[model samples]
Target: MHSLNDLLESFHLYAECERCQRSMQLSVEKLIARLGNDFPVTDLRPRLRCTGCNIRGQDLRIVFVGPPGKRMVFQYRR
Candidate 1:
């Protein structure tokens, strides 16, 4: 099980709306400040709401963005 604290360093968290397919990057620092560092990352799914469609369910994506100056590429398929 991964906590929010584990993601703070190298990983980037994103919330994607299942309905409208809207996606947004989340601030891990702000989240840790609010939800505490020990919060389970899996439990975050139900707590998220889509800003675009006002939906209650969200798909969480934990991406490895790597260190500075590293090349990163993301691919999405519908």
Candidate 2:
């Protein structure tokens, strides 16, 4: 199954350099933990903008899938 974390692994926005293979897979695991194992997130969106710049560059987008194919985005609220 294609997990959100798997998608994140390929994202370059979080990469410090070209040689680094983004291994922040735990973000997916933690998000799942918060949602509970019973709940499964299926998809994630494109890379979002960075804090330093308004550019929608490399970043993680987690799409928490719910019942009946519903989708909820996980992001920090200010």
Tell me each candidate's RMSD, in Å, in order.
3.1, 12.2
- All candidates' lDDT scores? 0.84, 0.36
lDDT of 2 by residue, 1-78 (tens): 544444333322121112232323235455555655444333222233334444433334333333334444443211
- Could you tell me which 10 consecutive residues in candidate 1 have the lowest summed lDDT? 69-78
Candidate 2 off by > 4 Å = 5-26, 29-45, 59-78
RMSD of 1: 3.1
Model 2 local distance difference test score? 0.36
Best by TM-score: 1
What would the per-residue lDDT of candidate 1 be over residues 4-75, giving only the tens digit for each residue? Answer: 999787778899988899999999999999999999998888899999988886999888766556737553
- The C-alpha TM-scores of every prediction are 0.84, 0.26
